[model samples]
Target: MNKCYIDGSIGQCGHSSRSADKAAASGTVMDLKKDFHMNSGAGDNSYARNSKIQGLIISKSQSERRKAAVAAYLGTGRPATMSVADLGCSSGPTALLAVEDIMVAVERACVELHGQPPEFNLLLNDLYGNDFNALFRSFPEFNSRRQGKGLCFVTGVPGTFYGRLFAAKSLHLVCSSSSLHWLSQMPEELQQKEGSPAACVNKGKVFISAGSPPCVAEAYRKQFHRDFTTFLRCRAEEIVRGGLMVLAFMSRKNREAALMEDRYIWGLLEDALNAMASEERIDSFDAPFYAPSMEELEEEIGGEGSFCIRSSDQFLVRWDDDNQYSGTGGEANVTARPVKHAVRMAKGVRAVAESMLRSHFGEGFGMDDLFCRYGGLLAQYYADSEAAVTNVVISLVRK
Candidate 1:
């Protein structure tokens, strides 16, 4: 399996490669049948694994919701045999969890279908760059689970989910979690905007200042819309009629909230990078794409014709902190430092941000600075013990 797909054509959410004729990177929108080579970018499944851990530590609500969505779909007059796909299956941890939850849900739904459970074909897909070795590491366990129940098959197929990786109307349910934010590679135009608003930054943070030229902002927004819409269209084709898809990902709040609080996080990163650069710890700077606000996400979804939104919910991630603080003012509001367990928690946050940074900037840039700065910001943000509702989960059924 190729890890990343390099094609500049912006599909849905600007992630999938529609054509490799142009320059690009992993997660481009294209016909599943189209001949193309896979790269390692999509194969970076560590984040997916980390996400699974984070999901458990932060929010299990979505897991329950996803299970219910599958059950609801099966309750319909669908066939006993169902095909399911996990778009960004990555290594196997998260994939397995999602598949198991789905299977469990299907089994519960089958109470009304008949006495026996539904025969299922579950496809676990990731970019070719994925660690197939690690992914297969769990196969023994998966096979063991298969012996006692309904006929079931699980396979690892490497590819981006942006395109139609499955047969048209072949999938009964599709679930992609914490993925789908990547647009088709990076925009060539955005890439070339060296000194423009699209590339503006202050205090090592990346942001569009009020002085940013309108064209750069518009260009970026256009690219995002085009890519996001294409993503929906491709997924629409892969889902069977009446099929259900529950996708959960990071999303920002309103512009005001994003700028005053969220934008500062990026700035904190800039401060970190500047510190690193000043100390010669790193050579350059890069910024990652982030969770779109509810408004932005809704706008994109509303424009797409492929799926109908059934339910949308926003929730806060429960930071794994006890709300302890130290110092008078400097670190006074910060969550009293994490424990040994926080070693993993800290790494997980760094991993997601690193992925975004590498995609935007290039390699050779370390995230230590970014991590430190954002760590403080996050600690401070959660200091008041306020509910940090920063994520949005949306469930959709094929139109």
Candidate 2:
């Protein structure tokens, strides 16, 4: 719903908020757009309150983002008004948290160059159903933090990242954190009917577990390949030559690490559901998520033929790591107090995944019962294995 035109007709990115809300409420909303957003407000269970892990991912990627600002400033010769976008910027404090870092970096860079800082035309992009209202409400807080930084005009662009959301050569820099693993929708192969020979019926599991057929994993890889390739191509067109991008997402070092993550994260959901209901829900459900290897990403970028990698990193985030903001538990907390860890992990999972789970099962599904089981599973998963998830952040410059 962004007023941005692919033919390069320019307008103020100002109308995006009003248009975003309208599109979100439309009767013809896409399946994933309607159910893919995080919990919308600042309540106890809201994404704003429970997204500490996502915030940490952003924090961990600070150096890359900082590097990006300077690289983009220099690469593009420091235009007077730089246009930047944050894709899949779901509604939360962390959303603006990313922008703040970029702003400070650019401002500092300008100072270092002994030049006037460029004003920013900042765009926040997400699916139609994203809670842009909450983001606007929190804008003042972000504005308060912008003292002495360049001017910023922030707006929302509502749409999926699978396709074009901006005009050609319209962007100077782009960034997304903790978002790329999500497939645009369920893989076409997995959605086939249960008894069909071609269907990936994932019999007793909800995701790619250790016992999954090789076909299931292949389906995931194929979808990620398709989606990520399309993503690079679209961004290539929108970004000015030499513009930079910083993307941070859940990733795997290889297939072995992939299974280890699946076992710890989605595996807990599988165990909880199996214990709560029969195998019926488990068999019928599949998470629309895939964590790719760094090689997989490199291959796609190379094939896309638009951007060259500048830098890449693999950061390991511990499951038991305690976050003061989230009140979530880590190894030390698990030993001192276990119940908090369960609550932490369960609430965090529910914040992001509950919407899709409820939509798949039923609106009236027992969230309490399921998450309770999920918490118990988390405690046990930690007791059994050294749990951590791999996150990869890559910096690229448009060719």
Candidate 3:
């Protein structure tokens, strides 16, 4: 994990591998340190890879809905000075698409502004440990796109949007996608059930049971609540009297029967580990993590004093053949199981599996292979299962 953190140059500005090398040499593990998490090392390029394959499909759809919501919130003859922020902005390539979208929206909104569009301030906020390398690599293109416009790019400020990444009453437009689900912290109390003797075997493994306790489940829910409510209040403080916010994120369904089960990808990965346990392959497996459902989000945000739902919906994204498991369709069998789990695990939770493969499995294990296998397994899972469609976007706005 330290090596992976070192390899990605996590938690710095720009794509200079020098920072990562220096950190590696210094033996500094930023991901495990006091103030840093969400580094590309911790999160991996999953979002980057998924964006290329998905191409703002759900995000763009949610963006369109958000555009309408923003327009409706602002109405006609809106002010000229507008500022927007994309919280949890990952790499440059993924972040750039939304910038382009926002620019187009600004231009379109300007036509109604009687010739002058709002002087827009677009902020890209993410953890300091993010992969700015990709962003720096694409800087030239971004500058060229804003040749004559007054757009600004800034980095590393206070607040974890999970809490409050910005100041009060300060923004006209704020956008985030596929990011809000991450909790500020993981649960510490949930131990594996007694049937699990392997739970006592290794200190390295801090495992959770397949059937998580109410407190464990509620921990994530409460974290989202605390982070989101504070986020809304902070945005409310920064937003003008009637400014707008456009948010799109992965949301689950609210029904018990229809609710996504562990058989779903996240849970299934944990289950697969449990399967390995039955075969005594490993001691125990930890449960998977996920974002809130649309209902949960709406309920949480609506209950918060600062925001009201302008518009929100759930939509599906089907898997396409082009985004299939690499050039081959399930040609790789034994290696297939680890592919999806590995990529999902890239955010740096399950380190033991990663280490074993590289040092013990003799399988030439690396990040790329882990990511590809992850993507392929996901593609295959979506292909085979009937209930495994990707979460739909939940669009929201400030009251």
Highest-scoring model, TM-score: 2
Backbone clashes, candidate 1: 38
Tens-digit lDDT string for candidate 2 (56-145): 789889999999988997899888998989998988778887777888899888888799999999999998878899988888888787
Candidate 3 ranges beyond 4 A from true positions: 1-50, 57-59, 62-77, 147-159, 188-210, 213-215, 261-263, 271-288, 321-383, 386-388
lDDT by residue (292-346, candidate 3, tens digit) is: 6766776777688676666666665533323443445565643443333333333
For candidate 1, write residues 12-101 as lDDT tens digits: 112122221122223222222222222213343245444544355224445645554564365434567778787766554555767667
Considering summed lDDT, which 10 consecutive residues are worst modelled in model 2? Answer: 1-10
Model 1 / residue 204 / CA error / Å: 4.7
The TM-score ranking, best first, is 2, 1, 3
Q: What is the lDDT of every predicted structure here?
A: 0.53, 0.76, 0.48
Better of 2 and 3 by TM-score: 2
Which of candidates 1 and 3 reaches a greater TM-score?
1
Error of 3 at 206 (Å): 9.4
TM per prediction: 0.70, 0.87, 0.66
